[model samples]
Target: MRAAAAALAAAVALTLAACGSDGPAAPAGGSGGGVTGDVTVFAAASLTESFNRLGEEFEAANPGTTVTFNFAGSSALATQITQGAPADVFAAASPATMQTVVDAGDADGAPTVFVKNQLVIAVPRGNPRGIAALGDLSKADLKVALCAEQVPCGAAASKALAAAGVKLTPVTLEQDVKAALQKVRLGEVDAALVYRTDARAAAAEVEGVEFPESAQAVNDYPIVVLKNAPNKAAAQAFLAFVQSARGRAVLGEAGFQVP
Candidate 1:
């Protein structure tokens, strides 16, 4: 009789589990659902994780809506937007990059500050080199990687370094922030200057070193709907979601400072 009762309970439990009464349905990928349409976003590389989660939420909130992203260095993404890329929105890691898009008339409205980020020294976990400050990165023996000055992170790095009046040659001038971070993660370089959010995002593989110079180059992340958006309404809604309380919480959790 006990065995029979256990089997019946198991069957009932299985039936309830299938009904989703215990928890919400798993989203196609991550989180929120609403209107159905396709919206393309050109975002900075540093925004990859947070934006991906945001995309899932946007899609869930707008049922049948597809939120696609082109995540790259802001400079590259800005160039694409200027070259007539069919993007529904633009979320740049820096205001300078966003202004480039707006100045080109590629965006529809004034850009809004969704989040802010700062630079940090990214070293492999355990910091094998025993490096701590900005000055340590300038050591002749350290193989440092930095983004090219044309990119957002690169520009910020340059400004921060200049604020300290310390100049050091990097072993490589990576084209983008992620690439520079990767150089450090792959043990190809001893150090790299990348966004604080990115460093935190890669916490398992890297340790972020906070330097005083970073305060001199805080980056403002701006987001906006595009002029040629195929689904402008959906795009605006998605942008709104990023500025919403839930969105702010998600971004903050990812190490971004909510604007």
Candidate 2:
């Protein structure tokens, strides 16, 4: 009886050990369905309004998660990311700017095109200058504001101008699209070349004029997760949210052409 009882106890110990070992394994790099923590996004100035809205929605959906944004010119943002700015995601206004990050291997994978934008003439609320087309911007009397050559909006403006055969000397070159549009809103300049979405966002202060030449300069917006993203899981989740159906609707309402 003592021997049998001892054997039973030993078997029970072994069974208990086996059951303990059956528990779930530890997660790798904190990845999985339960996405938490802060997600930092570096995006273009043109995406300011739409991204802000999306960020709010994402935070609401993912409790305990916060979405932070650094909105600036795509070129400037790219430079910042390459220089080691701590960002989980980067959304550029053009592919050329996104290439800078990819070239530096700062991106985790190939960037995906999220949307497209086109240039437009943002004029004051009342057509005070009677500016109708790209050609009108060439008039010496009209003080026009344009983005710097290095910025995506500026590059698109250059392409549209070239296509329209219009040589324009802008009164000022801004670092981003919003700054250019601000010149029009503040009555500091007669008009400015900015993204259609930006112009629409500021519709109460300015009006957007679409030109046929804009078709030649449509900009493809691209987004990517950084290689050293602190919260990779959350970053990926936010990226998917931006590419999701709900994200498309928000972008569409903001005048962006979602893909």
Candidate 3:
């Protein structure tokens, strides 16, 4: 009889042990869940500095996680993501570009506007050409670098110029805002129309000239998760982190107006 009792007790113990093991595992990083592994983000060129800072902070918060970024023109990034680029998240400089992902069904949900930026004329330090307004870009003697029409910065510049009733003949058309800004920094062009954030980030190298027409073409920045993200959990976590208070502080420091 004692043997029978001992056997039954052993069975009960084993059952209890199994039940305990079935409980959910604790998340790696507090109650935020297990946000380990890699998260690849495709973002607009203007977001380079701010996003890099955010990525480092995220990795530090989640020790086992890593954040990688691909910064370029928002339109190009949208095309790549739709074409099956392995991006976990996307941050666009304009709503139009973000809509491309939504239309292609690559976005997980409706994108949220994270920030807003306005156009500014980026010139070499000290404003050598003495550019003061959108109309100044029209002067044939003043070499100007403008972003490609397909790019967000270029589109904004176009609208700003149109609003100011000025037509500009760019000396060089760049594929991205950073490239356009680079031309000014390198003295290849007298000035370039880029985002206020970009000019502010490169304040030491370039000076941002605020024009009245810039208010007409403010760009809204949006962010979303890719539907086929390789690491959905990390993607979601990263998105949340970006919209968090700390994230806003980083972007604000870069001259991006929080939306």
Candidate 4:
């Protein structure tokens, strides 16, 4: 009886050991239902401040994931992406610019409008010029800066100016909104037409003037994942985070209108 009991006990131990070994294998590094590695994003210059904050928040939420950014004029970024620049995502200040990527078949899916921005006349902190409206920019004595027509801010500025029936020339045509705003900040120009959110971001250096014509020139901001993304899983996750409630809150704080 003792011998039989010992054999049965040994068999039970072997069965238990086999069950433990067969239970699922440990998750592999970087591929176990979790995002990992780097996600590269190409975004418009206007999104610099808000997107920077969003990038930090995304990295914190996903351990071992890195967020890299390339911020520039939406038109420029679109050219780069179409020319084969490796990027995981693209966020543009205007649907027209986003369409460039879509037309080139570089976007993985249809881009979504995430926010809206309007043109605002940015001036020195003290409003020394007394520039109250779009017509004010037409004063011959006033020097102004504007973004290049290829840029979203510049296009919006054109629309606002046309809407207001103002035919003013700028002292300089910058490549991006920040450059135009910089001209105002440095006092090189009396004023610049920039996005309301940008003026708010640089509140310490400039003040935004609201004009009725700006209502006619609001630009829609769109974002999409690249078709050839190296880290597609992480890219999709980052896109989701940008459209999430937390993302809307951060953008709202930055003065972007949720779409």
- lDDT scores in order: 0.85, 0.88, 0.87, 0.88
RMSD of each: 8.3, 12.3, 10.7, 12.2
Candidate 2, 36-124: lDDT as tens digits: 57789999999999998888677555544677899999999999999999999999999999999999999999999999999999999
Instruction: Please list the residue runs of candidate 1 whose C-alpha ends up more than 4 Å from where it truly belongs after superposition.
Output: 1-34
Off by over 4 Å in 3: 1-32
- What global local distance difference test value does model 2 have? 0.88
Error of 1 at 135 (Å): 0.9
lDDT over C-alpha atoms for residue 212 of model 4: 99
State TM-scores per candidate.
Answer: 0.87, 0.87, 0.87, 0.87
Record all residue pairs in model 4 with backbone atoms less than 3 Å apart, i.e. clashing.
none
For residues 1-259, could you state the per-residue lDDT of candidate 3 as single tens digits? 3234434544554675688753333233222444667789999999999998888777656545767899999999999998989999999999999999999999999999999999999998899788888888889798999998899998998899989999978989998999999998888999999999999999999999999999999999999999999999999989988898788888988999997
